[model samples]
Target: MTTSSLLSGADGAVELRGPLASRLLEKSPAMKRLLVYLWEHRAEELNEYAIATEALDRRSDFDPRTDAAVRVQVARLRQKLKEFYDDEGTLDPWRLSIPLGSYQLQAEPVTKDGAPPDLAIQDNPPAAAAIPTIAPQPVVAKPPASRYLWFSAAGLAILAMGWLLGSRWERQVQMSTASSSAVVVSPFWANLLKGGRPTQIVFPNPVFFTWVDKNGDTLLVRDPAVNSYHDLERSPSLSGLEAQRGKPILAQDYTVASDTRAVFRLAQYLQPLGTKISPSSSTELSPESADSANLILLGTVGTLAPYQAYLDKLHFRIPEHKQYIEDATPSLKAPVHFETVRESPTRIVAPGIVALLPGHSSDSFVLVLAGYHTNALISYLTSVNGLADLQKARTSHGNPEFFDAVVLSEVNGTTPLRSWVAAFKPLAKETR
Candidate 1:
């Protein structure tokens, strides 16, 4: 049969015959004809020109000038046939093939049992058989400027709300800090005065002190004139100590004089006790002397039998007291390269006395006696360095609730430690 006639017949019966003819036709009419030509003249050899001419039909309109386009069409159609058979006709009873330089078609039996050849043709019919259907979907378009405007408005609203909330929070925080500051009494001087002491004592704005007693007990001596002292015998004991009526002695009698010369002398005595001396001139401590001095100071502070018992109760060691100075020394001295080490050693000479006398809430004042050089001690006490270290320690030790507020003041450089008591004289007059 002519190639055209065989292709027409195959097209009509493609669904019943197999996927070969249907797939070839789906690609292009020229390719379908080429396939048919190959099938019909399978025993005949053919060249490219003959295949192209047959693909374009036997008409003058099928010019030699268009033979290249026709060949390309045929090649594309063959590829489509290959893809169809690979995807859906892999198990078909008939196999199709095309050899180069030849136009022919051949069918090979793919199934066993020697079934009738026509059975394959009857199995697939062209019409009335379902083919995969793909429905075209409509494309969607969006409005431009209005969408962006809505997004911008939402972003601005979020930013404005955040700014307002942040401002309000900041204001509230500032107010809270100011209020807490008024009531925040520092613990630096808590050990300097007795907790229950009723003495009329004055303290400077800033002070540091600790209790010398091992029990951490503060002595509360009553002022005979105050009504609170009248019931001292009936009142609760002072830090658990009995209250005895006696004239309060001046602080100078019990401690060193609070003057520069006194401080120098005290610092001198303390030199063997780890007290760092900043002399007017450059001087270096021998390594052995430095070690010996530090050892003595640490041993004396750590083993102060009275305070040791109390500190032990709190799990605090005297080494901890000097930790800040020791840790900060390297950083502090890095810039100055000061060979003569400047140090401030602080020790509490007395426990603070807090008296609940018959007066208003504001009538109370705390006594503090912090021992340090007028120069080095002032800088250490006023700076946030020590306070920050204490805060970090509290956190690391898992004692988040611990808070200490200290008032620190410098001793007069001109007077002795004894004469320095005048500076605190004014605190006794504070109204309740």
Candidate 2:
């Protein structure tokens, strides 16, 4: 039988004989779950966390410990498959194996004449006594030409069918691959504002925030409290704050659209006094002495109380930031106006900004936080954006659960950040 013919039929149970069948029987439950998931979602691209979480039965239950365990199981499963095929020898008619980094099942057929030794069994037994004999019978001969014609026709039909099916399968695979690449290569700003879970880090005192992206690229953003600004008077280099200015710090090649000049100015303003400004300062900062002088000075003009009041006044303008605060908005019972609640410990809300970066023709997002409760804010942000489950995974695992961890800053708060964080509680859990 030809390889194409092997794919025919709804059940296709016979086609799965040999190594594939043996592997299925021998695989562990976790390995089986992983395989089944890959088979079901073959048309869709999945990440490691998503695969592991699904296999574990609870997407929110992932941790480093669990992740390590799953990796070990998959390794063992791969080894077992290799040993099974090697022992069965080339006689096995089918190939069964999992490709690395991808949880996919690949199968192909071998010629029937190549059937494994274990599969060849005979029913007739040889006579114990040599005295038993039988007469030979005349054999009928078949035309070789007719047999060749039949085989050729079958081969042609299989080829035509394979071409049609294979073309469609190739298109599906291309589309899936393109979609996955787009998601993976998306810019940092895009992922931060609108993609995965959103994390807010509030700063009690100005501290430099730093974190690494998947590509090992470093991102540095100073809090409003940093007390120093970028000194535009100094020469620029590809390192430090100068390299970051103007150039879109691409995450996956996506750029932030917010005024690169403003970002440069912000970075400069955060630089401490006596710090030399970059030579590229002319490209980003105004040359006026007043502007240059004003650029480098940084100090806390007011406390959290006043800052919270200022934010409440502009609440309507900042939708993303306001949505987060409103969801976790604390209750107030008094003759106090919303602004009055700003300075009080109970009323002090952190100030945050969500800036959209433009790349090509689309917008990506970047968020900056100023005030107390950075961790709590990040937890809250992730929770509200349907990414709380990812946060849970990271908290349990001791590392981030997604592609990026833009920045994190420690700050004190009375309650667990999770307590104030709000999840997108669905009105109905099921559609039916």
lDDT of 1 at 265: 24
Q: Candidates' TM-scores? A: 0.21, 0.25
lDDT digits (tens) for residues 197-260 of candidate 1:
2322111111101122344332212211112222334323221233332322211111111222
Model 2 RMSD in angstroms: 27.8
Worst 10 residues of 1 by lDDT: 416-425
| Clashes (N, CA, C under 3 Å) per candidate | 48, 29
Kindly list the per-residue Cα lDDT of model 2 for residues 57-116, writing each as its tens digit.
646767533355555665666676667667753566555565453344444344465543
Model 1 ranges with Cα > 4 A deviation = 1-16, 20-24, 58-66, 111-432
Q: Model 2 misses residue 397 by how many Å?
A: 28
Give the runs in model 2 whose Cα sits over 4 Å from its true position. 1-20, 23-30, 42-53, 56-62, 84-432
**Number of the top-ranking candidate, with lDDT as the measure:** 2
CA lDDT of every candidate? 0.29, 0.30
